[model samples]
Target chain A: MQFFIEVLLGGLLSGVMYSFVALGFVLIYKASGVFNFAQGAMVFAAALSFVGFQNLGLSFPLALLAAFTTMVALGILTERVVLRPLVNQPPITLFMATIGLSYVIEGLAQGFWGANVRGLELGVDDVPVQWLMDSTGIGVSSFDLFGAGVAAVLVALLALFFQYTRIGRALRAVADDHQAALSIGIPLQTIWRIVWAVAGFVALVAGLIWGARNGVSFSLTFTALKALPVLILGGFTSIPGAIVGGLIIGSTEKLAEVYLGEYVGGGIDSWFPYMMALTFLLIRPEGLFGEKHIDRV
Target chain B: MKNVIPLKKTLAAAVFSVAALSAAVGDAFAQAKEQFIGLPSYRVGAYAAGGSGLYGGWIDYMAMINERDGGVGGVKLTWEECETEYNNARGVECYERLKKKGSTGNSVFQPVSTGITYSLLDKVVADKIPMVTIGYGRTDAADGRVFPWVFPMITTYWSQATTMVKYIGAKEGGIDKLKGKKIVYLYHDSAFGKEGLTVLEKQAQKYGFSLVLLPVAHPGNEQQSQWLRIRQEKPDWVILWGWGVMNPTALKAAAKTGYPREKMVGVWWAGAEEDTVPAGDAAKGFTAAGFSVAGPNYPVIKAIQDNVYKKNKGNMEDKTRVGSVNYNRGVVHGIITVEAIRTAQAKFGKKPLSGDEMRWGFEHLDIDAKRLKDLGAEGFMPNLKITCADHEGSGLVKYQQWDGKQWKIVSDWIEPDREMVRGMIEESAAKYAKEKGITPRDCAKEG
Candidate 1:
């Protein structure tokens, strides 16, 4: 029972991190209608920028401000330069362009930063904060608790923004139907720029916290891929689904690997999540929260 | 009025210039049919930081050979780079793409990845292409009798792991003193990580120490829980077998866990500028097993400056970090490949030779004192000799510690626990051969 509690907490913490990255994916997909394959690369690029600014010996707060500013500019530039021309192209073309965008971003990041892993300081000591109950122990990291708090705050802020703001109303209009939204005074292009900028800021925050836990490297990009099934399990267009899906996927992956791996020679964590997500897809084609769509083929 | 020629005249002049340039290029191409070496660099992938420096060093050296010495044996050598992105499948594609150049002479391969090395072992050997896996490869493949074309040059995981145990034994006073000492093996869960486990297990049995295996996930970013468990268990020594981001991250976790860095040891693969550069002050006193001695004043490096750089032959600018471990490995890789070619040149006489001939050269390779002096690698590494059975050349390693600034070698070159190594290699190799249905060759009968 003690082991189960520990593993469950471990899963939830990891799930929160996954949800953070998945949130970036959900934002871009909801607004741009393109699966941003470059989200991992964005994570890497954002982390590299944050680390680079920090390495310049700037104050941590100043470095963070500069990194966020840079990410906003980068988000705007990506929309203007890379996605603007392909606005009317087929969805496949848009998807392929994002793949190419991932490559270009990775290459450029390496060119600027060179290929070295960097450690991030999250302004909190990484020491474990232990808790004991009746001679039984349930220890958790202060850093992890801090991460969960940050995730909750960010999600609440996003929810409030989407529910009340004028731009939020326009974004919802676009998500319902781009053509119908364009029929009104809501400019599709401006809405996209806003959406991308928001997603990029989220990526920057995710990168900072993730880099704080694990040293940042080019391999950080692979984490975006790990968040793929999260999109499937949670509806790609639903923000709340992203968090719930991430937690479920993350917790289940840990539990399966810990309890079931011993019987099958280990290393089931890599494939088990995908299998579970596939089963969910078969059962709920529109995803856990996705609205069912009728295609006029 | 005085400005420009007519459009027709300008076009005519441009065509004539183009014709002349093509004629000159043709003559140059005729004069020297270039021998091409394919370099599959992992400069933008998982291990790109380590890959970039080594690839830069190697490409610079090859450029030097062409500019100063007019290539090896008077056939100018040129190389083209293919980014593998550190994927084994992509590396195989790069090999196929570069293997077809007509002027391809005894080419050498340095994949810098063990997974790719294992994937290419059979293909390159069958294709007769020489693979130079510096510092890491399959341990059993060191027996050239079974694997004739593959060369793991200086140090292998088995040898380094064995040597690390030896160092620990010495540090703890004696092997018997380690009977009850708890040694935790904190490793990345990959082929690269699992490679040294067999050797450590064998040493544990021999030395009577308790071994606790802790397997971390790939890319190995999250380890707070593992470290907490380690703190709880209080292992005496921690052996880190990790790569890329895992190294510095693990060190930081150790620091957070309040574990002394002096008691931790990393393998040669984990020892580099990239690993320590991240965890700056916290990683002080951490030790790793290094196979080669890389320094500023080595003879070969000076020779490179004199023979290759001074004449503007190689890319020997501030970019060429010769003293770094990865760069040294690259330089040694170049020396071994060139020596094997030279050895083949002695037997097959200078002209482009076949892969089997190169294989013969690798098996009967002898790099003695005179050869080292000739090759400009005297103090960098000890003389190496590869034979039918002895594929690793020599099971020697040195201990290095990070002083928050740079790596300083602390121990003299120590031989691996050979008796333990031999038994493990033979048993594992036999098991591998049986699984693959490969019969062991009787060397005495073959001669």
Candidate 2:
């Protein structure tokens, strides 16, 4: 029972991290109706910039500020250059463009900061919490727990921003109907840039936490693929859905690998989440929190 | 206007002379006696760290020879590095692109990747080019009769596995002491990672230890569940056959589960500084099997530093990596390649040897201790002799432990259980040969 509880907790913490990356995708998709494939590359670029800044001996806070600024600039540039040019085009064309954007971003990141693994110390201790382990007989990584807390705070801040701010209202209007929002003088282009900038911030947070957990490398670019299942589970446009979807995928995959993987030759953690998402797709095609749509022919 | 016409005429004459000079130089390059060594290098991708050091050392050593001695026996040695990015498909493309590049053709080819080696084995055999995989590749390639064109050279995975089990047996007092002892094989889920399982399984049967197999997927980062299982099962010892990011991640997982670092050992691929450095202090006392010495104190390294680095002709991005483990392995590879070329030159009269001649040189190659000293790499590598029957030469593996900073040699050179490993190698090689409809080469008939 104790071992089971530890596995469950571990899964939940990891799932939260997955949600953090998925949130970036949700923010972009909700505002623009475009599936941003370059979210992973953005995460990588942000982390690389942060680490690169730290390497220059800048203070942590300053380096972080610089990285965030860089991410925001990148977001604005991406919107103006890649997204704006391809606006009103087929969603598939936009998706393909984002995929191309991912490659460009990945190449630029590696080119700027040579493709080598660099350790990112967030001052979060990775050692198991002694008190928790002693009381529960299940070791839990403090770093993971701290990451979850940080993720929650970021999510809350995002939720508040989306609900209260004028730009947030404009973003929602644009998301509801881009043509309608444009007609109402909402400045659709500016709304897209703002959303993309917000998405970039989310990518930065996700990158720092994930990079701290696993040393920053090109591999972080692929970790975003794990969020695809989270997006499917949570709805691509629902922020809260992303979080819930990530938790479901994370926790269930852990439990499945621990209890059931041994019988099936193990290593089910790699594909188990996708299987869960596939099953969920059959039951709820619109996703757990995604908006349902009907088209009249 | 008159001065301008004269100046234009002079400029035209100068341009004509420069063009003629370049044409003559091009003709000289065509006629220059040189051997073209094909290097399928990877400077990018998941395994870039290892690739950089390995290919860096190789390029540096070859360049050092050219800079110092004007090339081996006054015959210039030239090489072209074709980037593979560690992808097998890209490696094949590199091989095909560089195979026929030189004046005579590619003298030798080293893919430096097991997957690439497997892909190129048939192609190299058809081309009669000797492919040196060194410490990693098909273990069955050790059987020269079956794999005539391929040479694993120093050691193969089977040998390394057997040597590791022997070291474990010695650590536990005796082979009989391993009886009922539980050992887990945590390996990367790939053909390269799974190569040593059969040998370990055979050892488990011979010695009565229970063996458990666990496979870690590629780019293995999150292994919480895998570690949780280890925590539950309480395996006595763990043997890791991982590469790239899997190495440090496994060490981290082991540390998280409170597993003893001393109780776990990694294969040579998992033993580099990059593998353990990321895990920080937790990686201390982690043992790994190694075939070559670590550090830049070797005579050959000094020669490279003085002759190549000092001249600003070194190929590595980071010069400090000159004596690192992977770099040294690359130097050893360079040594083997140069020695083979020299041997071929001695037998076939010095001018650029063909791919077939290089294969013959690899077959009859011998690098004794005296020869190693002469090559400025004394005590760096074990004395090796490749023959018609044995392509692996010396199946020796030594154990090293990471002491927070650098690897310290913990055990003397330990020889593998040759008889046991040889039997398995021959069986597998014969099975492969029969499947491929290859007629086994008659070693006795070969010179």
Candidate 3:
């Protein structure tokens, strides 16, 4: 029972981090209606920038600010240079453009950083807090508890901003119908730029936390790949769905691996979460919180 | 019209220069003045740090060889690296890409991944290309009588694991003292991690230690909870079988959980400057096993500096980082490879050796103490030999601790317990034979 609890907590902790990345993906998907395959690369880019600034002897707070600002600039630039040219193209073309954009960003990152894993300090003491009544009961790391709290706060703030702000209204207008939005004098281009910038900012925050945990390496981009299933499970348009879906995927994957892995030879933790995500997709085609759409001819 | 004649002459001069360059290159290839070594590296994947260090050191040593001694056997060695990115598919692709460019077959194919090792085992066997897998891959492949194509020198997973448990047992007063003690095995979930478990299990049965198994996924950056459980379980000791970025992170996690760093032991691959650098001083006192010489003061290392780096030919991005554990391992690899080539040359009349001849050389290696001293690798490794029965040239290892700065050797040159090793080898080799549909030679009956 104790082991199960520990595993559950562990998995939920991992899932929370994954949800943060999935949240970024869902935001971009809703705003542009284009699945940004480059989300992973953007996470890596942001993490590298933040870590690079910190390595330059800058204060952590100041480095984080610089990294966030750089992410904002990257957001605006990607929209202007890449998306602006493809404004009238099919949505598929935009998706493919993100793929090409991923390669470009990867190359630029490699050319500049020369591909080495840099260690990141989360600036939190990594000591464990033994909250279990008994000395031998389940415990949690201070780093993880801190990570989960910060993620919750970030998600809540983003939720409020999207619900109450005027820019958020414009974003919702564009999401409802780009043609309808344009008819009502909403500048689609400006809205895209705003959404892109917002997504980039979210990516920056996600990148720093994840990078702090994993250390800033090119491999951090893979965390974004793992977030794909999280987005699918959490309904790409639902904020709450992402968090809950992330926790479920994370916990189940760990539990299955712990109990079922030995029977199958081992290393099942890798593919189990992905399989769970696939199962989730089959059971609910519209996703947990995905909006149901009807089409009549 | 006179100006046109001068212009024509200038054009002719330009064409002549181009022709001359091609002829020079062609002539260079003809005389076999250069030894073309193919370096298939993976500097952009999960195992990038390790692969990069090995490749960087390899190129550096080769440059040292050329710049210091002009060349090996008066032949300049030219190498072009193809990036495999540590993927098995890419590794196979790289082998196909680089196999066509030389006067000779590939001198050495060192694919660090065990999965790649298993993949390339059959093809390289047919090609007779010698594959050097230092401290990795199928442990049963060490039986040269069965699989002569594979060379896993120094130590293997089986030997290392048994030795580590033996060391642990000794610390607890005796092997008999380990009864009922709980040992938690926290490993990266891969063949590399799985390879050590059979031997560990065998030893656990023999020593009466109960094993608690925990596997962390690859690119093992998120191990907070795994350690959290270890804290709860309060296992007597934790053995880490991790690689790449997983090492430092594991150490840092242990430090966070307040686990005594000395109580945790890592495999040889997990114990390097690269692994502990991220954790900094928090990783102090952490112990890990190593195969080769671990210190900075080897004679061959001195020669590498005097001959390779001083001449502007060393790949020493940071010259101060020379003689590091990984750098020394690279030098040791160079020593073993060059010695094998030289051994084959001695038997085959000293021009250049084929892969088959190199295999024979690897099989009959007799690197005694005197020879090691003469080769400038004194104190870097043990005087060892490889036989038809054992591709693992040496079963020697030492425990080293990360001292916040460098890996300081904490134990003497200890050979694996032979009775335990031989028994484990027979059981494992028998299992391998049954799985692969092959028969093991009965040395006793044959003799």
Q: Top DockQ: which candidate number? A: 2
A66-134: candidate 1 lDDT, tens digit per residue: 888877887888889988899778879988988999998888887887776767777776555644422
Q: Candidate 3 at residue A99, lDDT?
A: 93
Give one digit per residue, the lDDT tens place, for model 1 in B1-447. Answer: 344567778899999999999999986665445555678887777787777667766766666666668777865666778889889899888888877654544366677778889889778866888787778878887766566667786677898898888898888997678888899898888888898888889889888888877777777665644665576668999999988777887887787657899999998777887787676666789998887765657777776777776776654334446667777767776677667767877887765555666666776679888988876777567678887777778777888899887788888888887777777777777887788777766667642
lDDT of 2 by residue, B149-195 (tens): 99998888999998888888888998789999999999888888889
- Share of real interface contacts recovered by each model? 0.38, 0.30, 0.33
C-alpha DockQ of every model: 0.30, 0.48, 0.35
> Which tens-of-lDDT digit does each residue in B1-447 have in candidate 3?
979999999999999989998898898665465556667787665555556666666677677777777766666667778888888898899887776566665666777668888899888878888787888887778776567688888888888998898788878897788999999998988788888888788889988999988888887766655676687679999999988767777887787768888888899888877787767656788889887756657777777778876776677565666777776777777667767766766776555456677777777788998998887776677777987788887888888888887888888777786677767666767777788776666434431
What class would a CAPRI assessor give candidate 1's docking? acceptable
Listed in order, each prediction's TM-score against the native is: 0.85, 0.94, 0.89
CAPRI docking class of candidate 3: acceptable
- lDDT, model 1, position B107: 66
DockQ of prediction 1:
0.30
The runs of at least 3 residues in candidate 3 whose Cα sits more than 4 Å from the true structure, single-residue gaps closed, are: A1-8, A88-93, A130-138, A251-268, B1-30, B280-282, B293-295, B316-320, B423-447
Lowest-lDDT window of 10 residues in candidate 1 chain B? B313-322
